[model samples]
Target: MHIKERLFGKTAGKEVMAITLTNRSGASITAMTYGASLLEWSVPDKAGKFDNITLAFDNLEDYVTHRPFYGATVGRVAGRVAHGSFEIDGDPYQLETNQETNHLHGGNSGLDTKVWDYQTEQDDQEARIIFSYLDAEGSNRYPGNLKIQVTYTFTEDNKWKINYQAETDAPTLFNPTNHVYFNLHGTVSKTILDHQLFVDADRFVELNEQSIPTGRRPDVAGPPFDFRTARLTSQATESTHPQTLQVSGLDHPFVLNHDANRLDVSLYDPQSGRKITMKTSEPVVVIFMHNGASPLKIANNPIPAYAGITLETQDYPDAINQAHFGSIVLRPGETYRSETTYSFHIE
Candidate 1:
């Protein structure tokens, strides 16, 4: 089953806001263009009941107005950069810092503000919503007349396949990803303290006091950072680190088995009978615990702080500033392409 038919509504300036993709197994995923975010992921629960597992809101305005970063398509650079400055072609450039002295989520006017193009193809086992933007050189204070596109597709294989591509006119840095707060428990305030998790990386990025890279790659085998086996999120949260106070949860970058064109991650929630496998074509995975405060907008809503648990599949955060770390540079003839697939199954 896939998008059987797509309809265009009368209002809303001709944007394809609501799209549904049906899996071969009949499971479905929904997406909206307001933030170019995945709105709901409906999969089987423990008792075989279909439930929306992704934490979401009731309407489109919730996405546009919510500062919670609920399900956002982030770009330019997704994570934080110390003082929002990066060196491109041996020139140091500073970006607009929205989060204090730190540049966060690509500054104030990031990708979330733009609307994407959508097409519900008849042959696709999925529906895709695409967003394209042209960033002139030095737009984000980075050197590039960048043309970028981020596509979110829901496949019949039970995968949310997110693909990103960009080509820069000048030498610059680009790290883009979808910042989705995933919880198998379904949007609650409970500490993910007991949720068991695992990863296949041996080393992680060490950070300074402001969540900036210290330029040190540390081993995970002996620390609470190690999640090669099934381990609880609380264990990593309670462990010791040099910059523990800066990032409360697991807000570190893990060096992955690299590829010239891919990045991937696999996560599962046993209690909910949901298994999510993420695959991408990138060098670094910024795994954040979302341990940061929610700044919860709804005053009375019982929803607690949600963990980002994001596998930010891209170059390292603040990569433009670190020479030893790799750069996300693409030449005139080069095309920047990255794909991440999130496949879901019930155990």
Candidate 2:
């Protein structure tokens, strides 16, 4: 195994660094300190050709100007919070409503936009990069000073693992996830409609027109939402179901039926014979199919609609307000931990 680091660019007067970790099998993943973002995951397909399967910009200027979550670490909370209002221990706190009337992706300046401190480690079997950030208390109007560490591990067997750990000085909400969009065909010009997906979920959180949860957990027994068995992504994207039509694609959070020993999700592209099997400790997986074309270009090619898909394993959005959505509160003296693993292979 080997690791390399290079200067990526300058952002906010701070130098951003890109770290690449490679295993003996010729597979590698690269991450940047800016946003603690993932830039590349190059692996061989059935034909032994390597290609990056994630959506990413070629330069730092584009990432700074055009913001799609694209492989960035999303936090304070991963999804929308209703009206950006929540109470902690009877004290009501209001956050910036960056998205219409909801607080989306931790507000205008979330973890995804920050440059983090990092350290690297490696052994005979694996390589790792740890990215750390300090979220000051009252920043974006959230409580507590949060010290967070995000670790990415690349294994010799082609597994990409993420482990998140955090501690807060006071009561606060903490729910984070990585927003990496994957197009197994290795290019953003190609849509993911042909990819097959399987999600081990029986129900999904229902959202309103504003995309905030309506406190409903609807069963996924029929078309569109059902993914209990592997099915083409087009089966959901091309459907006329109200839920599918509402967002122009699949963007709902499905409550996961978690099993420590079982893989909970799988995505495969038959054309490339590449597959990703995922397992997470989180209770939900938000499946987002890129619903519209991106103005940005990848490798000089225009990004098309449904160019990629995100399997964001995270806690349910707006959990603080929804009684059944569970709690995301991290109080003093408590340690928060979440982990997810994605294994790649040729089908």
Candidate 3:
């Protein structure tokens, strides 16, 4: 195993560092400290060739200027907060409406843009990198001073594990997730429409016109939202189902089974014979097909809709607003923890 670090760039007078972790399987993951974001993930294909499967920029400037989350670690809250307003303890708080009418990914200048402290280590067993960030009190109009820590580990078995821990000094909302867009076809030009996906979910959250959750978990056994069984990605997108037309692609949260250490989702690309098995401790997973408009280009290549797939695991969007969904509130003495693992293999 090998771990290396280099000066990536400077953000807000702070130095950003890129750390690379390589395991015995010749698989590697590169992460930057600027946003505590993943820059690249190289895995072996069936042909024994390794290729980066995630969308990445060539420089830090592209990530800073681009609106696409890319491989960012989204925080404060991972998804929307419903009109950017939420009441806690009888007090109303309003957040930045970065996503038009709702608060998206913790508003503008969220944790994804801030510099984080990082530590790296490589042992005979695996290579790991841990990132830590502190959100000051009322930094983003939310109460409490929050401290967050996330660790990324690469094992010899080709498993990538992400562990998150957070605590707050006052009652506040805390939900963080890694927004890593994957293109397992070995290239960004290829769309993931042909990939086979299986999500261990029976119900999915319905969305409104503005992409806000309606606080309903409709059964996914039918309609365009169904993924109860392994199915080709195109089957859902090509249909005229109302939910399918709403986002131009899939972009809703799926309720995950409560079984711990069990597989939550599986994405397989037949073209490259690469498969990814993911397990998470979260209750919901939002799978986005990247159907929105974007001018951001990665590696000098224009990124089009459906170019990548983002499987974000975290608390459901607007959990604070909808008490029935689940509680995302973190009190002063409580600790928040989440873990997600992606095991890579060739089928």
Candidate 4:
């Protein structure tokens, strides 16, 4: 395993770098200090031809200007929080309403847009990069001084793992997830609608008109949301179900009943014979297909609707406000940790 680093660009007068980790199998994953964002993931297809399967911009300017989330690590909180406001211990907190009137992806200036301190390490079988960031108290109108560390490890076995750990000085909420859009055929693949997806879930978080959770976990057994068995994206999109009609495609959180760590979701592209297996410690996984028009220009090409899909592994949305959804509160003296892995191979 090996790692290579080079200047990516300068953000806020601070130099940003891109680090690439290469395994023995000749596949590599490159990420940038900005957002600790995944810039590329090159893997071999059934034909043994290596291709970059993750979507990203060709230049740094696009990332700094647009909020596509792309292949970045999203949080302080991953999903939405109703009305961009919440209460803890009877104290109210207001967040930036970057998406409508709700808080999305940790507000406008979240971890995804931050420049983090990163370091690379490697052993005989794997190469890993660790990114560290500190979210100052009241920085985003949120309480608590939080210190977070996220590590991405690539092993010779073609496994890419993300490990997150955080600590807060006061009671706060935290849910971080890598928002990487994947298209197994290639980053420039026209659409991911041909991909087949399988999620080991019997239920999904119900959403309101604004797409926020309604504190309900509806059964998915007979709906288009039922992805317990592999189903083509095209086939799933054809349903006239309310969920599909509202979102225009798959964009809901699926319940994860597995143990702390095990495979819970998988996606396959029959044309290229490429497949990805994802496992996480989080309780749910949000599947989001780029449904509407995206202003992103990735790889110097215009990104259209349904170009790629994201498997955001993390807690449910608005968990803090919805008691039934569980808690995302991180109390003092507690250390929060979560792991998610993506393993790639050809069928």
Instruction: Estimate candidate 4's alpha-carbon lDDT, on a 0 to 1 scale.
Output: 0.88
Tens digit of per-residue lDDT, candidate 4, span 80-150: 88998988889988988888899989888999999999998999999999999999988667789999999
> Top TM-score: which candidate number?
2
Write the residue-wise lDDT of candidate 1 on 196-259 in tens digits. 6666677888988777888898888765778766677677667766444466667788887644
On the 0 to 100 scale, the lDDT of residue 311 in model 2 is 96
In terms of lDDT, model 2 sits at: 0.93
In model 1, state the lDDT of residue 263.
29
Strongest candidate by lDDT: 2
By TM-score, how accurate is candidate 1?
A: 0.87
Give the range of the ten consecutive residues with the poorest summed lDDT in model 1. 4-13
lDDT of the candidates, in the order given = 0.69, 0.93, 0.87, 0.88
What tens digits encode model 2's per-residue C-alpha lDDT throughout 1-347? 89999999998899999999999988999999999999999998899999999999879988888878899999899999999999988999999999998899988899999999999999999999999999999878899999999999999999999999999999999999999999999987679999999999999988899988999999999889899999999987779998889999899999998866657999999999999999999999999999988888999999998999999989999999998888999999999999999999897
Error of 2 at 270 (Å): 0.7
Residue ranges of candidate 2 with Cα displaced over 4 Å: none
- What TM-score, computed on C-alpha atoms, does each candidate reach? 0.87, 0.99, 0.97, 0.97
Residue pairs with clashing backbones, model 3: none
Provide the clashing-pair count of each candidate structure: 11, 0, 0, 0
> Which runs in model 3 stand beyond 4 Å of their true positions?
259-262
> Which regions in candidate 1 have their CA more than 4 angstroms from the true location?
4-16, 136-138, 189-191, 258-264, 293-301, 306-308
Ranking of all predicted structures according to lDDT, beginning with the best and ending with the worst: 2, 4, 3, 1
TM-score, candidate number 4: 0.97
True lDDT of residue 342, candidate 1: 80
